[model samples]
Structure formats: structure tokens, C-alpha cells
Target: MVSLPEELQAREAAARQRVEELQAEAAELAVRLERARAALSRLEITRETVMEVLADLSAAEVEAHDAPDPRETPAPHGIGVMAVPPWREGLVAGVLPDVYRDIVEIVADAPGPLQAKQIVPRIGLEATTAKIEGTRGKLKRLVERGWLDEDTPGRFTLARHEGDAGHVNSR
Candidate 1:
């Protein structure tokens, strides 16, 4: 049989090899995680763009028709997914007040959830506490209107189908 000292050294070598393997695996996983995050960010932007286009088209259709079409429904949040809120299904700018429109735009462009104070700089508004509070209120209203989703108590992000107006009826 092998000596005890030799056996301990052999076990140590095996343990070291296992550790190296684990380290390599962890590195690979980290790379994959980063790639996934990038892809998700790109996809979110694409979704927002598509929703905006759809909303503009729907608004044009609504203007041309001069009558609400019963056949069309609000554009879905995703591929064949559930419908978004009615306000987001058309030209939000046409419907919402100017301040609300600015709020939506600011939140939509944010990379992640944004607090009201952070929004003031991006939207070119005053940075007073009252202004921040007002921003918070407006953000909350947008959430109520289905234009945004509150990621946390005081932070918000754009909803997936934010600007999606469902299919427009052909004239």
C-alpha cells in the first residue's frame, strides 16, 4: 500500500485539479451571463421601437377613419402576447399632456429603473425636491395609465407594449 504522506499529496493534487476545473467553468458562465444581458438589452430596445412604429401607424389610421374600429385590438406586449393598455395602443403624445409625454420618453430611454430625481436631469427639468416629488407623482400616474411599470417604490421602467397599438384596419 502507498505511504500516508504520499496518499495525502495525491489527494491534494486531485483537489487542486478539481478547483481549476471549477474556476474555468465559472469564468465561462460569467461570459455567458454578460452575453445574455447584452442580448436582452438589445431586444428591449427593438421591442420599444416596434411598439412606437405600431402606435404611430394606429394613430394615423384612427385619424383617417374618424371612427373607432371595433375589429382592431390593442397591440400586444410581445409576439402574440397579451394586449397593452389602451393609452399605449395609439399616439400617446396626441392623448397625454406635454408633461406626461416627456415623462414617458424619459422613462422609455432609461437603461433600467430610474428614480424621479434621476429623471429631472434627463428631461431637463429643475432639480428641486418639489420637482422630484412632482416627477414621482407623474411617474406614478403613468404607471396607472399603463405607460410605465414601477420597478420599485419610487423607480420606474417602460412597459413592454408601451407604444403598441394593435393592427390598424386597412383603409
Candidate 2:
């Protein structure tokens, strides 16, 4: 029979080897995670660009044919904000996709800063963790673009318009 001490040493070596393998796997995963995050950031920027182009086209169309709705609240720079619900179309409607604009409108109209969970029901999206995370990502982008403000981590409110220093709750 093999010696007990020799068997224990072999097992210890095997365990150490497993630990080293796991550490290597963890390092690989960390690199992959960074790559994924970078790709996502690029995608967000592309989406923002596409949205801006669409908004410009829409604004041109409006200026060419449609008379301004006196009932609609006009933005300071003439960027139209479309209605989210009770609010009139102004800036959010002009620049963002329906979902992103809705998110901004929800936060803009909220009595206080709102978390993703709190926003899901009002926005009528199904409450999934992925959906909530997507909402969080959009909110972060809006903050980066100066459309919304992160009141705290994972909580959002309307951003103050740079030109609207006196305008109350301009989104």
C-alpha cells in the first residue's frame, strides 16, 4: 500500500494546482468583462448619435410644414420636447428614442429621485432584472449627456438645462 503521508502530499499539490488554474480563469474572465464593457460604451455612443440625427431630421420637418402647437411647451433652444404623458413635447421627445425619452420624462416629472425599480412600473416595462439594468444604463447615458442627473447611485432626476437657470424642472 502507498504511504499515507505521500498520498496527503499528492492531494495537497493537486489542490494547489486547481487553485492556480482557477486564478488564471478569473484573470481571463476579468479581461473579457472589460472588453464587453468597452463595446457597450461604444454602442451607447452610436445610439446617441443616431438619435441626434433623427431628432434633427424631425425638427427640420416640423419647421418646414407644421405650425408650432401653442399648447406645447417650447424648449429654450427651440428643441421640441414631445409629451411623455401629461407633459408637452419639448426636448426629451426631440432627441431620444421613445424608451429613453420616456425614462427622462418619468424622472423629470417625478416628485423625487427614482430608482430603476420605481421607474419600471410607471414606464410599463415588465419588471425583469435585465430590463431594470438596461434602464439603469440608459439613465446613466442621459446623465452623461446632461439630460438627467444621478441624484445618487442608481437614483435619477431631471437635469437642469444649462440655459434654463431660472426654468423650474426643465428636462
TM-scores of all candidate predictions against the true structure: 0.44, 0.44
lDDT of each: 0.69, 0.69
Rate residue 169 of model 1 by lDDT: 17
Residue-wise C-alpha lDDT for candidate 2, range 77-166, written one tens digit per residue: 333343222222343344355677678777767889999888887889898998898888877777776677786888888877555432
Residues 45-115, candidate 1, lDDT per residue (tens digit)? 99998888877866765477564542343233455332323443443433444566677777766678999
Clashing pairs in 2: 80-90, 81-89, 81-90, 81-91, 82-89, 82-90, 83-89
Error of 2 at 98 (Å): 0.5
Give per-residue lDDT, candidate 1, residue 58: 60
Superposed Cα deviation of residue 165, candidate 1 (Å): 9.7
Worst 10 residues of 1 by lDDT: 162-171
Q: Could you tell me how far off, in angstroms, the CA of residue 156 lies in candidate 1 after the best superposition? A: 0.3
Candidate 2, residue 168: Cα displacement in angstroms equals: 10
